[model samples]
Target: MIHILGKIFSIISIISLIFAIFTGNLSQLAGAMLDGASKAVTLTLALVGTMGFWSGVMCVLQDIGVCRLLAKVIAPILKFIFPENCKKGIATDEIAANISANMLGLGNAATPIGIQAMKALSKANGDDGTASDDMITFVVMNTCAVSLMPTTLIALRRAAGSANPFSILIPVWICSVVCAAVAVFFAKAFALFSHAGYKMKNARDSAPPKTRESKAGTE
Candidate 1:
């Protein structure tokens, strides 16, 4: 459905563009587009370099001990984040580590690790089981990440030949921080709800043989 909607939107945009051109509005549209492009070039250039550079750095980090170090740093938080998996299953560990790398703006580095993590989680949970809150949290957490450096934006800036390439640093930081906070809050909230339901069920099940209700038949 999303793909179809996207196609429809694209077709509409193309038709609009064609109509504008036929009606002698193409020059104005072109000028407006060029202005927007010019403004974005700086970010584009910065982004390209940062993404590639950080990606390589992350790969090297994995090859070395940096990724492990990061995993270690985040382990405590991960434990709290995934209360159900206290013992660090291979799948859980991989998922946490990959997510940590992605948080550092290393999506490329996270790919194989993420894949490995998913397979492990699936195997652990079984084929019939759906994704647990931990799994969903990991996925959501990755999407609205809080990046320390706006490498991609910087690359875009550089590509666009911005005189002041680092101008968007603060904006990126603020945006990322806000987005990450919201994502994490939602993830934890959902996890808490799920955990609470499990606890309620367990507590009810374990409540000492059900007192008067079960004894009524015997009486």
Candidate 2:
């Protein structure tokens, strides 16, 4: 689906550029492209410093084992939610660090840890890289993660010249909470539904077949 969308957008861009050239608006197109590129570069530069600072902070937390302490606090809840590996347990330290980065709204910092967690989850699945229930649950949690600080959003707002950059903090928290709740609810619901279906199928497969004698006796 993503590939298809990318192709569609690429074709649209090509067609639009062709149309602009035919209409003698090539100079306008060039100017617009240059302006967009400049803005993108400026935004990237502005974000780089903030991202680096947060990443370093998270790294320091990990080195100092603060992440492990946080992991210990949340381990029971994590184990409960992901029962597949309840016995073995997931890598709590990595997950906790990832969650911490997310809560701080350091998405760039969170991404590496999130990737590590995904790899750990994939190994726990014991499959050919196919996503398991725990993996799906983690994905849902990460997608709808609550951003308590939302530094990135605040930065964007500041760049846009908002009078109060952090004004949306409360709103962001509310939305994140609602989204995460719904995400977890649906993920669990689907997991239960699939498990029930598998059990029903297994029971049917294991049931004994009626013999001819039994059928005749019944008749």
Candidate 3:
């Protein structure tokens, strides 16, 4: 589906650019766009090379079991964020592993590990109707996660000829951390409300229901 959408968008963009050229209103602008794309070719290659280097380094770390060890260290933190798993006695080791990889700014490495972790979490939940609170919370937590190092962003900025590559580190850290914290807090708040409601419904259903005749006779 994503590939199909990409193909559609690519065709649309090519058609729009051709239409602009044919209309003659965008002659100079089109020329400038072409120049920019030409200039970006070298920068794009540099960025890809940097990313590839870092990704390879991450792979080496993974092979050496350093990443798994790091994951074990952070498992407690992950368990706190995903309490339903704790309640269900479902291990989140793979998730912890994936998160540790992400923390090191290796999102690609984290993905397959996370997918496996999700499968494990689902199986532990033992039902298919709705995802468990832990699963939802984990999704939210990962989606807005605070990255330790913006390695890819820094690499891209450098490739784009920035004067200082690491200049934005402090600001990025502050903003990403704040956003991650807010996201996790909201997820936890919603999970709490959902759990309370579920428990309330369960209690209401389990208790004896009052009948009109029984109440009248008691009165």
Per-model C-alpha RMSD: 7.2, 7.0, 6.8
Model 2 TM-score? Answer: 0.66
Ranking by TM-score: 3, 2, 1
Residue pairs in steric clash, candidate 3? Answer: none
Name the better of 1 and 3 by TM-score.
3
Q: Name the top TM-score candidate.
A: 3
Clashes of each: 20, 0, 0
**Could you say which candidate leads in lDDT?**
3
lDDT of 1 by residue, 1-219 (tens): 999999997997698799997999988877877787776775565566677777777677678877678778777776766666657554667866786777666776788888787777666666457886656776787777767666666766677688988988888879986887688789889878876776566557756456435444423
TM-score of each: 0.63, 0.66, 0.71
Question: Candidate 2 on 119-151: residue-level lDDT in tens?
Answer: 888886675766777778888989888877676
Worst-scoring 10-residue span by lDDT in model 1? 210-219
lDDT of 1: 0.72
Q: Write the per-residue lDDT of candidate 3 for residues 105-143, one digit (tens) a residue.
A: 777778898888788878876758578766777788789
